[model samples]
Target: MNWPTAAGSDSRPDPDSEYWDERQETRPPGERRDEIIEKIGEQVRYAYDNSEFYREFYSDVDVDPRNITSFEEFEQLPILSSDDIKQEQKEHPPFGRFLCIDEEDIARIYGTSGTTGRPKVFGIGQDDWDRIGEWHAQILWSVGLRPDDRVIITSPFIQYLGSWGALAGVDHLGCTTFPFGAGMEGQTEQAVEWIADLQPDALYGTPSYALYLGETAEERGHDPAEDFDFKVMFFSGEPGASVPSTRRQIETMFDCEVVDQGSMAEMTPWMSNSGCRHLENGMHVWNDIVYTELLDPDTEESLEYGAEGVPTYTHLERTSQPMIRYWSGDITTWERHDETDCECGRTYPTLPKGIYGRADDMLVIRGKNIFPSQIEDQLHALDDYGDEFRIVVEREGALDSLQLVVEVADDAETGPDEFHDLVRQEIKSEVGVTPDVTVVKQGELDRTQFKADRVKDKRELAIDV
Candidate 1:
């Protein structure tokens, strides 16, 4: 099918097309907060009246959703986490009452990756699916995806949200989509060969998988940039896409703009860090469908714009499986920039910096706190280390310990012992912890085709020992 193309170019839509444009343009800074609070109240009342889960959960709170209008009262409601959703599903079985509609009404079923526990089953009605597709289309446009572009997606389609949502975006954009599902078995090589032939204009996957493809392309003597006219490389499922070192590595290898896309299966497509221009700032949230708030992680108290805190999101569009005051577990600082204009002239509130890291991912070792991303940033700084790595967590005595396992680059001749010492010193300097560093041969550790599972909890091993 011939895709729809704009009259002049393949760039993103005019800023007016952004969901937040009208609200941001018309409403003054002071008024926008009140409007958002009112919208939240309306959404709460609608969900409580219509959704079984919210109705039951809020029954004990004993307050009219309308009266509980301001952000102050909104914070009074108990925070809902992934664990809460999982427990509810466990008690309800199959599709949870979190769903507003009956099973017959569900058009699609998608689940979380279940890396932590049982995958949370989320149902999407036809309208919800369409909304998701539209949001993804906006994200694609934000990152320079055009109707004439051909895209290859490397995320898994196995009941996961990333691949399906991204595919929907390509379809919505009227671009040709090649679903090269994850897994580095024989299929990955074949997918690379196909991309070499088709020469898709864009590619999407986690940073690790994208790097793997680049390495594979090099082995086959095929330069992806030269062979395929790729303009954008979209990445998600990990923070590597936003990290400077990682982004530079991918762009240098693939010869394209590496754009970071962020969302959860529960939230679907909420925001994309890729602006109309290539500045890798914070993600532009879809204010029409989702409302976001930052709260002090410890106290759960809401923080004003530009303050760094944990991110909590409320779905404004979700009706099938409504999530209100859902704690995303990601920590970030947000600001509504009304005066500062981006190069693209989009007036939507910008994140300036994408998600920092999950509050849960923080590890306290030797009285020092550290995040896996910090370790990742430090490791990526090393000249001879491969992009693939993992941070294993274990309990030693009464304290938690961290170990760094990284793959050496192909050209690096440094021995594992020397490399380990270098990594150990780097961690001590950066994170203030002397983590055990182990350098493995190139491709020694299993390379993930989807989200890279870096942390392996070895508390059981510590107990056994």
Candidate 2:
């Protein structure tokens, strides 16, 4: 299939909305700071007025919200960590004081993906949900998705924000949606049938799950690339979509353009960042709606533009539960855009590699810091290996032994030992650490319906909150 031409637009990229500076996405950083500083003060004051928890937390910090005039001073107000939110909700039972909406106005309540720990609950009012859908449409339309397209969502639509927000986006564009919930007994076969019957132009699912569906379609005597008329493959909830090799593999299997995204449950499913036509591999942060800062993982200081750090977030427009200075442990790096222009001509800030790793998931093995995304990148680049693989970490006496257990192709030209040696040498060369490589036969690893269990760290999980 051919890559789509730059095709759609959203008027949301305005020059100004809030006090003539909300258009920071298109303006230069130096010019935008003044307005951002103003909004920061207003946001803190709004939180202090609307949420009791913020008032108490700020009171404990012995600081006045009125005195917070700059970004540094605003950051000094204190960080709202995920674990802290979870504990507060536990103490308060159900929703906590962090919520900005009243009980009567709460339009919907959703739980976190709970991938890392206990799921933190979040809510949205009617207006909040509308804004989310509208913001999502901006990204969708920016990436060439249009109203006339037929989209099929394979993600679960219960209380999870992923499925719900995706459908909301389709609504924003007035696109037709076929909600095929995930993990149902005959979901795969049924999805294949729908692809054959309705002929959708787009699909929404996790990267691994989408890859598995392509495999399933082929296994059930159907040619995925031939039968499917898909043009866009929108993915989130995992790292595979952003990895170069994985992107290529999925595109080849389904014959579509892959656009990756970054979002979290507590942050609300507005899709804070998304891929645009300009940077197919990189995702642009919705600076107009969300303020994202990368902080040095060790020092907690803001990292330089090119430096990799954890993404700390603030929901600029979210009213139900505005996450002000929520320290997200997810690791990434970003770059500012200029009028020099992307292929699509939008000047939004871009995450160069997207969300590659998390600070909490970092592994120290044989004096080298490793992340599951690195191993995943290596596995995807290998032509003979299948999409499924897992990273296993075991304690070998005093030292931790790292093993990359990957699956080899069914019709392999090289023996298992030779393939293993190649992977070992390549990983050592790329990641600067030698790893034990085990080549399993095809279909040895588990096929996941959602996020794949990539890193299995059997060593004691001691991560400080």
Q: Report every candidate's CA lDDT.
A: 0.73, 0.77
Candidate 1 backbone overlaps, count: 0
Candidate 1 minimal-lDDT segment of 10 residues: 1-10
> What stretches of model 1 exceed 4 Å from their correct place?
1-35, 66-68, 272-276, 336-342, 396-400, 413-418
Give the per-residue lDDT digits (tens) of candidate 2, residues 1-465: 111112233344332222112343456666666665666666677778888888888886655785567777776767778888988888886787877778889988888766667777877788778767777776777666777889999888767788888888888767898888798877888889889899999999899899889988988888889988999888888888788888888889888899888667677654768886446686877765677777887777877677788888877656677888888888888786652235654556778688987777888888888878888888788878866777888877787888888899887788888888989988888778788888888898889777777788888774435
Tens digits of per-residue lDDT for model 1 on 378-416? 887888886678888888677777888888887876777
Runs of candidate 2 with Cα error greater than 4 angstroms are: 1-25, 60-63, 66-68, 113-117, 338-341, 461-465
Q: How close is candidate 2 to the true structure, as a TM-score?
A: 0.91
